[model samples]
Target: MAYKKETMESDCIKAILDNNLMFQEDIFSFVGFARSTYFDRSLDKSDAIKKALNDNRIKTKHTLKKKWEKSDNPTLQIALYKLICDDHEFNRLAGVKNDITSGGEPFDIEVFIVNGKNKTKKKD
Candidate 1:
């Protein structure tokens, strides 16, 4: 039997959106298609399926961003900061330890925790 695009397209879209599937192989597997069929049918090139997958992924990202924004979790806030902030700002906020010296010697370290303020400690 051959795979029918007309019959499988809707199922593919539904599975993608329902499962929040982001990978082509996962989507094809969820829809019960062989890997060879996926390539032979050019399912990767199908605009409808591609659009559905991209849209679903973007929608999922937006939902997660919203949740992260609305919550008061500092970990998530720091994670979001890491995504948007420059290396300097992120290091300032999350703290960075330079544990190796230019001379290849162990260096003192300062660890910062996001518990409302920054704290520092020296490595023993």
Candidate 2:
């Protein structure tokens, strides 16, 4: 049995919004549509489906940001930081020592590098 385009599109949109899915496979799986059929019908190329996924992703990010801001949980804070902070900031806050020297001895190097930047390392 073949499904109507409208039915398939609506089902895919609902699956995306409801499941907060951002990937094509997850959306098609949740909606019980075959990946090949989805691609063949160009349902994967639908602008509506793309917009729904992007919008839902933005909404989820905003929700998570708000929750992270108000909560004092260290895990949540770290998770959000990992999501938003650059590699340098994350390493600094997490106490990740990216020491390139093989031994414990401090060598006289002209430039100190952290996350690809050559400057004085900030005290965490």
Candidate 3:
């Protein structure tokens, strides 16, 4: 007996949706199917069955925002500035300066540098 492409796709989608697997590769492995087979039959459809299955998947918006906030660490930012000013040496010639302010302020930092004989103010 042979199953229609749509039926196979729905079955695959059911397996994928019910399983604990989060990644495409993991789902494919769990079902003992090839990537090509899984994607072509399911993920490749216009009304992609895989998309419907994973529709309720939680997004990592909070995690990413937290990481971004960490990356914007004031200490790290200042350290980078100091490193640039000390190591680059040319920053002085380029007239690069670090001016930072904090707390609900309009801007966190203001950088004044001479660019082609004109003073440029950069806000971060």
Candidate 4:
């Protein structure tokens, strides 16, 4: 299919000019540009248009985050938290230490079986 120019929002144009890492998918979706068209345009489109598509991605993310936070559903907030939080790396980044001391003294760690089941038993 032939590439066709699509009308993009004025804000989107400004977004591209302001940000260097705008999400192309958001720009394409917002401007009704096909993926193929986007790639093709990337090769020949004016530098200004290219920059706008790249920079608009941040605006897209900001918009989504606002919606996620505003939603009344609990899961939406959790989803927003996941989107913003780096919990997986929090422990290392926060300088957390992994040391376990029992009653400030050495303790015996034992394993036992009961009813054909095994479980850990800690003793002081």
Q: Which stretches in model 4 have alpha-carbon errors above 4 Å? A: 1-47, 89-124
lDDT winner = 2
- The residue pairs that clash in candidate 4, if any, are 16-52, 22-54, 23-57
The lDDT of each candidate is: 0.79, 0.84, 0.56, 0.59
Per model, state how many residue pairs clash: 0, 0, 0, 3
Candidate 2 vs candidate 3, TM-score winner: 2
Put down candidate 4 lDDT per residue, 1-124, tens digits, no spaces.
5544443334347545555435555554444456666666553355666666544666777888899899998888877776666755554544684546677677778976667854667787
lDDT of 3: 0.56
TM per candidate comes to: 0.62, 0.58, 0.35, 0.36
Least accurate stretch of 10 residues (summed lDDT) in model 2?
Answer: 111-120
Tens-digit lDDT track of model 3 for 11-119: 5666667773444556565554566765565555536554744563543434444554578687654544554455346456457745443553557467776565645
Q: What residue pairs are clashing in model 1?
A: none
What TM-score should be assigned to candidate 4? 0.36
Q: Ten residues in a row with the worst lDDT in model 4?
A: 3-12
- Model 3, residue pairs in steric clash: none
